[model samples]
Target: MKQSFVYILKCSDGSYYTGVTSNLSARMFKHNSGFYPDCFTFNRRPLELVFYCEFTDINLAIEKEKQIKKWSRAKKEALINDDFDELVNLAKKSFGK
Candidate 1:
């Protein structure tokens, strides 16, 4: 089975980019090489890979990527830092529930 990955890149400008890929190494190379001028991470080069999770299903990977892309910076940081408690707390605050 082919593996998929959901990744977070910390841009040079202190912003984050979330994406999903089946070939992570190749994707990283493309991002760092300015392969896509119109891409969000194109100008935000010198990116640091802050987080990644593997999935056997591409659909799940894509779903996770979309979800992460919608997250607040604080929530994304919490996930990158492996702070699940903070993640849940931030989610609750964001939802006000």
Candidate 2:
């Protein structure tokens, strides 16, 4: 079965970009190479791969990408740092709001 990936890229400007891809290496190359001038990562070049999770199902990968894209920066950072405690706290805080 083909694998899919949900990834987070840290832009040079300190912003995050979330995406889903079947070919991570090729996607990273394209992002760093500025293959598409209109793309979000085009001007935010020199991106660093911060986080990634593999999925056997493309639908699940896309769903995860969408979910991450809606996350706050703090929540995203917690996830990137593998701070599950902080992640839970942030989610709870958001839920209470």
Candidate 3:
């Protein structure tokens, strides 16, 4: 059985990064250790796992990753904080509310 995970990392610079992987722990280790060649987190080492959601299906995980990647920084923060209402507010503001 294979499990996919959608995860977000808060970089040293306070920026958020969204990605999906089958091996979350291994991926985090690689990101922190710079073992994954040419990875986006290669230079952004020491990232903290701010958020993660597990999915049984790869497509669902990938879809969620893409969606999170498209979110605004405020929205991402809201998500990390588990503030659903804040996420709604961010979305409304994004649309010129």
lDDT of 3 by residue, 1-97 (tens): 6999999998887778899999999988888988986877777777999999989999989988998899998889999999999998777744455
Report the Cα lDDT for residue 69, model 3.
Answer: 94
Choose 2 or 3, whichever is better by lDDT.
2
lDDT of 2 by residue, 1-97 (tens): 8999999999999999999999999999999999989999999889999999999999989999999999999999999999999999988744353
User: What are the lDDT figures for the candidates, one per model?
Assistant: 0.94, 0.95, 0.89
Per-residue alpha-carbon lDDT of candidate 1 for residues 1-97, written as tens digits (9 for 90 to 100): 8999999999999999999999999999999999999999999899999999999999999989999999999999999999999999988844455
lDDT of 3: 0.89
> What is the TM-score of candidate 3?
0.88
In candidate 2 the C-alpha lDDT for residue 84 amounts to: 97
